[model samples]
Target: PPDVEQLGRATWTFLHTAAAYYPERPTPNQRANMLNLLHSLPTLYPCSHCASHLGDNLKEHPPDVSGKAALSHWLCQRHNDVNERLGKERFDCTKTDERWKDGPSD
Candidate 1:
């Protein structure tokens, strides 16, 4: 079985990559689908402890799927929340697009 760290890394990679590629101006259906995916994570995620924490966080800070930037920022905040719990450094939310989508300039 995968450990929590492995599961978390894989999950975050998938989420950030997906958010990176999400339409800048998603259609109604796309927004709905993204919302569904986000909402399902807490319940469907394999790590029970992680899932519970995410569920609690979701209640406190509901997702913002208004647009690509909004969604990406929201995910970054959520990732920071997890990092805080793990005593990890917080990622710079401002660099989300560069980190997730575009490579940093040399």
Candidate 2:
């Protein structure tokens, strides 16, 4: 079984990558589906404490399902908030595409 930290990292990676590839102008159905996925996480995530915190954050900020860029930025901001709470270094949101979609320049 994965630890809480491992689970968290994996979950974030999946979400960010998905957002990175989401359509720039998604259909109404697509947007609704994405919103459902995001909203369900707080209830579905395994870690109780993490789920509670995520639920609170979602209530405060909600998910930005306007488009790919908006969703990516929203997720990045939420990730950074979690990183701050954990005393971890926050990622640079500007480079989200590079980090998630494009390979880093060598």
Candidate 3:
């Protein structure tokens, strides 16, 4: 379709721009844990607009970030800004974390 290409480009631009101010820029998810919960994975983490972990910090240097606008966690940075957002009283909202984790650990 002739219009298909133009439409696709426009859609991409809209999506990219919207992600620019996403709150959760990064998230944390254990691969092993994901595997274990293959049947029922709990998406219990913040993610950047680009769908990256809000503040997983599961890397040595910078981390995997989609070329999306939501990836804007910091001032052209990543982890630092995302961390601050997570600490705010919005995502976790304190009221949620206080009762998030239950039972014991191994």
Candidate 4:
């Protein structure tokens, strides 16, 4: 079984990548599905402590699924919140596409 940190990193990678590929203007169904996925995390996530924290955060700042940019920024902010709690450096939300979609410019 993977540790909490490993699980978290993998989860974030999946989320960011998904957000990167998300349609610029998704259909109502796509938005609803995205909301469902985000809402399910607190209940389905393996790490109880992490899930609780995420649930609390979600209550304070719900997911923004209006569009690809909105969702990507929302997820980046959420990830930054976790990074702050863990004393990790915050990722630059501006570079989200580069990080998650296009390869970083060398």
What lDDT score belongs to each candidate, Candidate 1 first? 0.91, 0.93, 0.32, 0.94
User: How many angstroms is residue 75 displaced in model 4 relative to the true structure, after the best TM-score fit?
Assistant: 0.3
Model 2 segments beyond 4 Å from truth?
104-106
Candidates' RMSD to native: 2.1, 1.9, 15.6, 1.9
Q: Give the per-residue lDDT digits (tens) of candidate 1, residues 5-86.
A: 8888888888988898898999999999999999999899998888999999999999988888999999999999999998
lDDT of 4 at 10: 88
Candidate 3 local Cα displacement, residue 68, angstroms: 8.3
- What are the TM-scores, per candidate, against the unseen true structure? 0.94, 0.94, 0.23, 0.95
**Model 4: colliding residue pairs:** none
Error of 2 at 55 (Å): 0.2
User: Which residue pairs clash in candidate 1?
Assistant: none
Would you give me the overall lDDT of model 3?
A: 0.32
**CA deviation > 4 Å runs, candidate 1:** 104-106
Give the CA lDDT, 0 to 100, for residue 73 in model 4: 99
The parts of candidate 3 lying over 4 Å away from their true place are 25-106
Q: Which tens-of-lDDT digit does each residue in 54-82 have in candidate 2? A: 99999999899999999999999999999
Model 4 local distance difference test score: 0.94
For residues 1-106, could you state the per-residue lDDT of candidate 4 as single tens digits? 4599889888998999999999999999999999999999999999998999999999999999999999999999999999999999999999999899998622
